[model samples]
Target: MTERGEGSNAALSKYEGYENWKSNIPVMYDWFTNHNLVWPSFSCRFYLQGTDGFVPHTLMITNCDVVKPRVKNAEDISQFNEEEQSPFVQRYKTLIHPGEVNRIRELPQKSTIVATHNNSSNVLLWDLEAQPNRHPVNGAPASRPDLILTGHGNDVEFALAMCPTEPFVLSGGRDNSLVLWSIQDHITSLGSTKGSPKLGPRGVFEGHDAIVEDVQFCPSSAQEFCSVGDDYRLILWDARSGNAPVVKVEKAHDADIHCVDWNAQNENLILTGSADKTVHLLDRRKMFVGGVVLPIHKFEGHKDHIFYEPQWCPDRASVFASAGEDGILNIWDHLKVVGNNNENARAKTRSAPSGLFFRHAGHRYRIVDFHWNPVEPWTLASISHDVDKTGCGVSAVIMLGTTMKMQEQKHGRHLPVYAFDMLRQIWRMSDLLYKPEEDVEEEVEAELIQYN
Candidate 1:
């Protein structure tokens, strides 16, 4: 519960109640699970390569289960067994203590837990499952990052996409380059007696006219990768090739391309968002297989027209999300675009319908970026920035579908909020992964209203 105000007596009562809640493990755990609270399990730490480097801190989890008033003192303490408690709870009693909760009312959704000061241009990798208290298997600090691969001359952006098929890392940054590194390289670099030998770059993807904005490995093929950039181009390269892109799509957008996502269901489909205020669907198969150039579809709706990013839904093959300067979040159905195209082709002879299946108008500011929750495909988290008014700021909101009613029911609250925006930007809630089509509907019904 959010504390609205603090009268001296009321504050004391709140503290007394908090102390009671912290002392009871079973009651607290049950309350947490029943309310569907999520604890933070992973964090990302970043540091500028030079001056005063490698500061160590801890990233605290946010959106924890709400604490409730304690049961009467007579409640059976016999039900509490030492083994029932999580190691985390035992180590951090302050996490459950009311005094701590009151002091840190808003949990640290995302923060730098560790700092690095290596002068070599390198990228850092943190193992998500590493225990916070143990040394990493490499004998570098455990529960901390397994390795730090320093080798970039410029600021790194999106430099840590973990490959699903292999224990490798794919990253690109302002240096106009891409590098693939292995976990073993990190282990060896630690120089610990027990550390594994450091691994070096497995491969490097080069050849871009400008700083690369995004680089994605094909979901099904580790042999191929795609990238986009400020030069308004999309290039597909062979992972084995250290030279130029085999296929260069110039003018992929009219302005700088901010993001790119490959459709997991259809490897031939490429989706890109740009500062040009347009989202383009390029049929990769057409370019490579048919030797034809065709834009499968295009979306234009943002007023200010700066689209920051686009994400393809993992559960549904045809579904996608895009956010931009208009401050609206859009969910789209690609099936509708294909259907409309087929109908239009047949209509030099007849007249095709002129609408698409999509949903919009869910945010109040420029949604800087967003990610679909990996565990729950129906849910998404986004960060929005409102820069026009006083006290206006950035916030994070979790979007839920009607299907997740059980989880929503557990929380007893459903409206979105702006409190967690900064957190969403730090730790990625999910990665773009391909799912079997059998798990989701192939056709999207046209019930969604079109956004103007």
Candidate 2:
């Protein structure tokens, strides 16, 4: 995505190009709508540019059924009926190619087109209410973005969380602040030829003493949001409120907080991982130490500084998975407190004592980030760094371990074995699978041969 001022002219050229492509390309209508010979599914695509001060470059749509294309010769264009030749019709005629006339004839009447520029300085919204697809170009635009949001003081490091409600987006930056923006307004304001769209901050959450590392909205509530920072603090805020956090937890870890996630099942439960080599679970309702902080558990197995991202299981709220700087990824179950009557104490006494379900230590270098696939709960993805004689590279590794198997081996002496292997750069089991002394090498060798 290009920056605001830098991309406007280029985006306008692209917008014109899209119009020309729509008019010229016959295959786009068939490809986009799947040639049902009738109505088809419609959607919008957005393009954005810029980092420090970005803006929307284009907002166009394809709603070709309502507005029919008006044909006119180059010399007799002025003679075309003004009432019949709307702005879209004139623009469509100018943009489409002559050879794609057959495709335009098959255009659906009810299509929608939407595009956004980078950074978010400029936004354009096509009145697709009346206009339909008359442009003919297919895959003419190299890239199209639906929304372009800007106004970050520094480069954005990561995508924190998207708003569960409303057309809003939230992001954290090195500037030490969290920004909430209304993307819906940014898109709606594009049609305004008057003053610049009133695209400004909806709310600025500022409790972090250091650069904010991560920001996440409660999965259950739209108004509730949480942010973690390098200052070792996790602050919970009501987005409708002002700058100060409604609730705050201090000294979350001894080191900087790197990542945080909220429990999908419980809005009050928050999980945070930090450089202090500890992960803390805090109850949002209990803002103070004297206010009953629910300490679920903490994992302290990593030998080196932890750098991997922590994620919770999609199916089970009490289960969470994490990877670390020690090149090990672990899955842990947060022992649930049955009732309010010292249930945790009772369970601790009767249980065989479970700490970690499965641990995979196979990366050549440190595992940078890991993610649990939403589609398959048992599957996971890990990105790791490799700096060996072969050269420096990054690998995406997939792990397949069923949750049922993990629970079965919860307190067993032998943990359930899970497979971890490389995905993109090469196909091989991680070094963790190659323990020379174990007789299991014979079994692993056979497995490797089968995969190869």
lDDT of 2 by residue, 191-280 (tens): 333432435567766776677767777875667788887787787888777778887777767777777888777777777876765667
Q: Count the backbone clashes (under 3 Å) in each candidate.
A: 22, 45
TM-score of 2: 0.52
Tens digits of per-residue lDDT, candidate 1, 1-452, equal: 11111112321222323334335433222222111112111111111101111322222222321112222122332133222321111111001100001011010111111112221245544322232432112223313334555556676544235444545556666778777665533333332324323346777777776777677777776667788887787888786765568898887777777678887788888888877767788888665335434577776655445444477887777878776666555666666557666744653453322223333332344445555644443445554433332231211122222111223423332321112212222111111122234432332222233331
What residue runs in model 2 are displaced by over 4 Å at the alpha carbon? 1-146, 185-199, 291-294, 336-354, 389-452
| Alpha carbon lDDT of each predicted model | 0.44, 0.43
> Against the true structure, what is each candidate's TM-score?
0.57, 0.52
Scored by Cα lDDT, where does model 1 land?
0.44
